[model samples]
Target: MKHLTEEDLVLLYYSEPEAPAHGQLHLRDCPECRGAAESLALTLNVCSEWVVPEPDAELGRSVWAQIAPQLEVQGGSHAKRHWARHLWGRPRPWLWVAPALLALLLGTFYLGRVSKRVESPVMAGLSNAARQRILAISLADHLDRAEMLLTEISNAGDSGAADISSARYRAQDMVDEGRLMRQSLAEQGDTATLALVDEVERFLLEMANSPDNANAAEVQSIRQRIDSGSLLFKVRIIESNLRTEGQKS
Candidate 1:
């Protein structure tokens, strides 16, 4: 019969079945196999008797250092192996540092772009609203000043020509402001504002073109036009409405 192997002896020493049936029958019948198994058991027990020393913390680093060279040879690429080596021992400062700084800088740049994009719509809305408010308030103020001018013209004393240059200059200035407002309104096809501005424009142009020093006849003629058009009342109402709308906006 063939002798049992060292493996069979080890299994027999541990009482592990090497075969399901007639297991170790040869070992039981043969003195040589039996002796070999007992000898293996004795050797194993003697090895177990030697106390294993506990490893220190440095043992882990020592083991990785020992394997690092073999890993580098198998890893293939010089750059990749260099990076992997950094994972075991003290990494060169720039290895992790440069990549971390690059990531942070990229993150900040992308974040700034996102924030500006996110805020654009809101900022645009605010700017448009502010422009509208300014236009509304300006138009209201212009109307208030024009209303005063027309009132003065309508109620002027009939005494033969005083220095009417102030009123004429004021009328020319109003015309200028009114012309700009009218052009803007006309472009938008605002028929209502156009109508009021038309009435105010006629008064302003007439006053601006009339002689600097005017007679009672001219003053009366202008008053007649103001009364006929109800220009003052119309401007006052429109100005009041615009101011209220501007406030709400």
Candidate 2:
């Protein structure tokens, strides 16, 4: 016979009304399963002694009185008895499923709010000059963070196991940021801006895809590319120019 799962034993021990009949049959014929069920029962019996706040008798009666009318409304005793059986039959599934559904609903609503804010109408309503200022400011912030991530990796000292994991993840995020900014610049036919953004994305992709626990040699190789190509210098200059132009607008 297959050994009973802990979940199966727990439901049997608790004597859940909906516990499967197969479980009951297995417990009778299977000594191993029966022993497990007995141990679980002992544990649960101990837990049942935990102290719980008791309602005042008067309040309990008053609350019962209020609900009694509703319960009585589903026809007389026979109809009410069937309703009661189904209501008490299996509440555990709903205990979990209800909260999961509620959380999913809340998550969807919150994400919708964030999406609206990111695609804000305020930016869209701005004049052509104002829009450039907004783009410049947003692009400047993205480049600043990207430069920091690259600089951190470039300046990492040759040592034992260097964890560039955080930098790697940040660079991944910057790749997405750069993609969006690059698209904005492309719409304006800004070749210079687009070229620099493409270079930034290229290096960011390299950093993001690399292993987190990079050794000293790996760190040096990345830094060498940045140095040889003046990648960091170009980003810094472009970021500064965007900020300067943003201020003028």
Candidate 3:
């Protein structure tokens, strides 16, 4: 039996028109898929209670005003036009996915805040155990992905001038997610976990800033940094502990 992909589950979760009816049927018939759907629902339901702040209406226009002039001076009319198309054109897959992922991470942060400051009955009803499980699951998943990316780079043995644009893109997302997790961990006063996230964020920042096609030396440098600090080992250790906590919760 074929399981529904994550993308399929996400679309189904949102009740997007694009989601096929068979997905709902399959979810009912397949215990694995049903469990996966339930997990997604749990996370989303918890996050829905956390309110995200609205952005300033002028923020986008203001930032554009600052950068538009520079774009023209640097690349002339063609560059500015290209950027305009890229920004305002039909949305790309990454464009859609990035915002959702960011919202999920931000939701984790806001959820923590709401639990502390708000006295709403709905918020009060969510058990502390539930909250711990959510945080543990989120952090464990984040660290697992981070570990995979770092391991890939570290094991890029002697591959000359590899195209690492994919890794770079992933690193950029990780950097954003890591910062939110770091903020959440700090608020909870988990100093040890906070320190690990700090180190991971720094390394992820370095990866995010790396060139698309990094040369052998650049690759080795990243690997050395990861290895020197034993970051992967530490991430795995914490991830294992989180999984245990998540299960117990």
Candidate 4:
């Protein structure tokens, strides 16, 4: 029979009083394993020793004196408990609450400023002009993207295969984004912006739903409408006026 290993002896030494009966019985019957196990236990107990120097009888009083100034009187127990509750009880909930409260306060402050601006005719007019500038900027960006799409499609060779597919998808996405922006402008209750929204919506619809595979003629027509709208020039003028008004304010 193969003799039991040192690991078996160590396991028997530390295991619960009622570990495997067979291991216990082997340790009892095997003198060599029992001696080794005893030695291992002695070594572990020696390694675990900790030596602490004894303090003088005055040490307790000295420690208490040092800590007394830092300790609050019993009357402050309620205050300390309140502080502990505030610090640890529901930190995650407070973490969420704090940001939400801050956001609400910021929103309230912003709305108050906006209300003041809206109540002033001059400021309201400038705000309307600024919005028109943004709409015009959005229109210009849409047209630029559309123009790029047309250019890509035109340059695609006979074997271009799916090269222009990504461009077409991007152009379609621009159309959708422009439509949503125009809807927002319409909701702002500004007649000038509403009119521009109508014009831009019509243009974007034409580009988005053009013949399955648009031809050069259709591209040219779209380009002509973009130029006639003078969208980019209008954007620049409105933006300049807004900047001037902002500086004055």
Score residue 209 of candidate 3 by CA lDDT: 96
Tell how far residue 53 is off in model 3, in angstroms: 42
Q: Measured by C-alpha RMSD in angstroms, how accurate is candidate 1?
A: 40.5
* Stretches of model 2 off by over 4 angstroms after superposition: 1-121
In angstroms, give how far residue 31 of model 3 lies from its true place: 72
**Which residue pairs in model 4 clash with each other?**
none
Candidate 1 ranges with C-alpha deviation above 4 Å: 1-129
Model 4: per-residue Cα lDDT over 1-249, one tens digit each: 345676666666678564455876777787886787788889877877966778889999998995564252211111123333553464232222222222233333346567754343322344544544444444444444444444445454433233333444444555555555455445555566456546655654665566555455655565566667865445444445433543442
Q: Mind giving the per-residue lDDT tens digits that candidate 3 earns over 75-107?
A: 111112343355447433332232233344446
Evaluate residue 44 in candidate 1 and report its C-alpha lDDT on the 0 to 100 scale.
90
Pick by TM-score: which candidate is best? Answer: 3
Candidate 1 residue lDDT tens string, 78-144: 2233433543354343322222322233333345467865333322444545645545665676676
lDDT of 3: 0.73
Candidate 3's TM-score: 0.54
Top-lDDT candidate index = 3
Q: What TM-score does prediction 4 earn?
A: 0.31
Q: Name the weakest run of 10 consecutive residues (lDDT summed) in model 2.
A: 72-81
> Residue-wise lDDT of candidate 2 within 107-150, one digit each (tens)?
33345467865433433455667666756766676676667767
